[model samples]
Target: MEKKKRFGVLLCADDSEYVKKKYGGYFQVFVGLLGEEGETWDLFRVVNGELPNDEDIDAYDGFVVTGSCSDAHGDDVWILDLVRLLRRLDSMRKKVLGICFGHQILSRALGGKTGRASKGWDIGVTCIHPSPSNKLLSSLCIPSHLLIIECHRDEVWEPPPHAEVLARSDRTGVEMFRYGEHMMGIQGHPEYTKDILVNLIDRLLRHKHIQTSQAEAAKASLKEKEPDREAWKRLCRSFLKGKSLS
Candidate 1:
């Protein structure tokens, strides 16, 4: 019998009440998107300082770094530790997938720069244009442009020297990037549903992270279009599972 593939999620955020009740947390959301038959997934709440020991890193097929409310460029102790861990994973050539803040942190860990966005928060479904050189996406059934859920104030200013920018948007230059064959990063949340994004927008507004007008604008954008969730699922699963794009 073939062995089941094992995956780990390095969760970088605390679960909101809605996420906990609806999906059991962001970890479950990702597993729902990426997990398949004969696959097992686990979580490490890295935001809470829980991490898999370095010696045990080889146990999983790949690791996913989840989004965070914290700044990727912040000098927090746990953030520093996570950066070091990412560096170690890169050295091992382990497959690593990063989302949002995860994307920024991966860039930082790999000798890139990340900082506040010049245009302020992007808090809605935005279209991303994939690069022509991203041959891995050729096998997927998608259009020239893909819409994805985005809610971020920080952006990747520069990608690592060895990384290739895979996608870009009008608001952010590096929407997606690939490092070598084993590492990839996405600035948008492919795992999120429209309802989830709506809830997040409300939360942001309540916390004063964004103004009421901005929240209304973001919600209005959602009515105009929807994210290409199915295509994103296929693309992300193909990358994580080592499946050929062709």
Candidate 2:
């Protein structure tokens, strides 16, 4: 039998040791980044554990960092370790993708900065445009007015010296970027399902991002709109196949 390609999924959040229910969080982002690549999903690291060391990376084809509740600017040791892991992945030319906090870490690791961004949270869906196309896009440029779910308070302020900005939104110009060749980061939660986002919005009720009523209203509206399965498949295929760019 042919060997199945393996990949790494690391979580930066502190998911209390025991999960009361089987649901989303880092797992959701992992599936989003992967989007049904193969029958058996290969996750290297569990949620809320120590980041893996250098030699550990050889076990996977690429790495996917999940969004964390912790801010990238904070002095968390684990956070720093993940950043180091990112650097190693980039140097090795392995595909690296970050979502939300994942996005901030990628930028900061590449000599950029992340903090209590001047831009506030983009809780609901927002339109994104591909500013600069790449080979992965499959020769079909999406409409400039595509709506994607956005949910990050800490935005990526800049891309590294050699990194290029791939997609942007009116709210935050650094919504998406490509570092080096295959490495990429997205501020928006492209992997988010409407149901999951709704639950997440409710989970973050304590935060002053969006009002409970507003989030609830948005959730109701989302039920009517269909999830962009094509976009999900395209991203997954492009990254796994190593043809990402456009």
Candidate 3:
């Protein structure tokens, strides 16, 4: 039997596993796995605090940046170092994907800025509307509305140069964008499931990151906002099979 293709996943944080669980664990984290070309994906955890440079960064087939529970503007050296790594990756035109914190990192690394969210923490699913129509949207499994999990307090004030705004949401216009398409970043968590959204909402409410009323409002909004699962699945597959020229 032919082996699965190998993609490298530069797992970025302690909470990565927790986030992975939200998306069905290791099986659906969407991080690239690297191995003998035809082997399975091997998620390589890279703690940015340790600081890795180009030599340290070049070994992966692809790279994935995860959301950090830590703040991007805070004095976390790792976050700064990650900016360096992402800048290098961007220069090389590598297939890099950043979600949430990852997205902020990419933007900041490329001469952009990140700050607090305009609406605070968005704890449930949201509807990301495609910026305009294209092949990527052509394969979507649902309507232009994409229902995915969100939990962030910061956002990109301005996207990097050469970036394309592929999708946006009413909650946050930077819902989804492409760093050249093949290299993409999304503000929402498409990898997560409905149950995961519920579980995360539970966790956030328990910790007071969100209030009971907010959770209730978010749930009701999501019910009416998100696209179908099949549509989301189509979006994922489209991302996986990125443009040949991106």
Candidate 4:
């Protein structure tokens, strides 16, 4: 029998009540999107100061850093710790995939710059054009433009040294980037569904993070176009599983 592949999720956000009730927390949400038969998935609530031990790092075939409510540029202790962990992971060439805040944090760990976007928050469906110059990305067989669900105000101002920009949008310059073959960072939430974005928009409005007008516009945009979920899933799975994309 073949050995089971193990993956770890470094969850950086607290699950909303809606998500907890509907999806059984973010772990299940990620597992639902990325889990496969004969594979074991583990969760670590990094927001609550939980992380994988150094000795146990080798146990996981890959690691995913989930999106967070906190700013990646914040000077919080946990954020600093996560940065150190990422640096260690980079040195070992461990496969690490980052989303939203995770993406910014990963860039920071790898000597990149990140900050709030000048154009403000980008919520709802966004179309990203893949970089034709990236030969590795071309092998993925994805379309020239991919529609993905995005909910972020922070963006990667600059990618790390030796990192290649995978995709970009009109609002965000670095929508997706890759560092070597072992690490990738995505500014959008490909794992999210329309419903999740709706709930998040509502929450953002309630918290005054965004105005009602912005929320309404974002929600409206969703009705106009559906995300390319299957393609995003294929790309993520191929990258994480180290499979031939072609």
Candidate 5:
């Protein structure tokens, strides 16, 4: 019998009540998108200071870093620890994927710059154009413009040294990037559904993270277009699973 493929998720955010009740937390959400049959998925809540031990790092075939409510540039203790962990992953050349805050933190850990977006928060579906410079991306046959669900205040200003930028959008320059063959980062939420985004928007308004007008505008933008969920899933899965486009 073939050995089962193992994957780990470094969850950087605490689950919201709705997510916890409906999906059993963000881990399930990620697995729902990326998990394959006969594969084992594990979770480490980095938000609560949980991480895989160094000795056990090689046990998984790949790992994913989830989005967070905190800024990637902050000096929090857990953030610093997570940075160190990311650096170690890079040195190992293990397959890794990052989303939103995870994307920013990965850039920072790899010697890139990340900070608050100059244009303010981007909280709706936005179009991203993939770069043709990367051979893998070039062969994916993705459209000239791909729409994705984005909800981030921070953006990657510069990618790490030797990293190939895979995609970009009007609001954020580094929508996606790949470091070597084993690592990738994306600034949008492929795991999220429209309902999740709408709930998050309401929470942002309730907590004053965004104004009511801003929230309304974000909601209005969603009606214009939907995210290219299947394309993103295929691209991300191919990269993480080391599959090639035929």
Candidate 6:
């Protein structure tokens, strides 16, 4: 029998009661999107400073850095630790997929810059135009434009020197980017459903992170277009597993 692939999720966000009750936390959400039978998925709640041992790193087929409520540019202790860990992963050429804040942190780990989005907060379904110049896009058979759920105020201002911009949108310059074959960052939440976004929007409102008007507008956008979740799943799975695009 073939050996099972092992994956790790460096979960950055603390799960809210709603998410825990509904989806069993962000870890489960990601597993639902990327997990397959015969694969072992492990979770590391990095927000609380949980990480895999250094010697065990090689056991994982790939690692995923999840989105966080904290800013990627912040110099919090855990954030700094995460940066060091990411640097180690990069040096080893480990397959790493970063989402949202994860994307920004990965850029920072590679000596890139990250900050607030110049276009302000992008908090709804967005149409991402994958760069035609990227051979990987063509190989993955991804569509010209993919609709994805986005809820972020920060973005990667500059990717690493060797990185290629993979996708872009009107509001954000680096919607998606890749540094070599081992590292890729996506600004949207492919694992999220419309309902999860709705709940998050409510929480943001309760915490005054966004105004009611913005919340309403974001919710409205969701009704306007559905995310291309199936395509995203295939793209992520293939990239991490090294499956051919065909």
Worst 10-residue stretch by lDDT in candidate 6?
A: 237-246
Count of steric clashes across candidates, in order: 0, 6, 10, 0, 0, 0
Give a tens-digit lDDT track for model 4, residues 132-170: 776556776788989999999999999999898888999
Q: What is the descending lDDT order?
A: 6, 1, 4, 5, 2, 3
Question: Cα lDDT of model 2 overall?
Answer: 0.69
Model 6 agreement with the true structure over 94-163: per-residue lDDT tens digits: 8899999999999999999999999888999999999887766787678999999999999999999989
> Which 10-residue window of candidate 1 scores lowest in summed lDDT?
237-246
Tell me how far the alpha carbon of residue 242 in candidate 5 is from the true structure, in angstroms, after superposition. 1.0
- lDDT of every model, 2 decimals: 0.92, 0.69, 0.64, 0.91, 0.90, 0.92
TM-score of each: 0.97, 0.84, 0.78, 0.97, 0.96, 0.97
Report the number of the highest-lDDT candidate.
Answer: 6
Off by over 4 Å in 4: 244-246
Superposed Cα deviation of residue 24, candidate 4 (Å) = 0.5
Error of 1 at 127 (Å): 0.4
Cα lDDT tens digits for candidate 3, 1-246: 743444555556665346555554533455322122344455555554544445745544466666666666555666666777777777877777777877777777877667888878776667677754666665443466556778777887778788777777776767666766556777876555566567667777888888899889767766766635556555554564444423
How much does candidate 1 score in TM-score?
0.97
Q: How many residue pairs clash in model 6?
A: 0
Candidate 1 residue pairs that clash: none
By lDDT, the better pick of 5 and 6 is 6
User: Ten-residue segment with the worst summed lDDT in candidate 5?
Assistant: 237-246
Clashing pairs in 4: none
lDDT value, residue 224 of candidate 6: 98
Native RMSD of candidate 2 (Å): 3.2
Looking at model 5, the pairs that clash are none
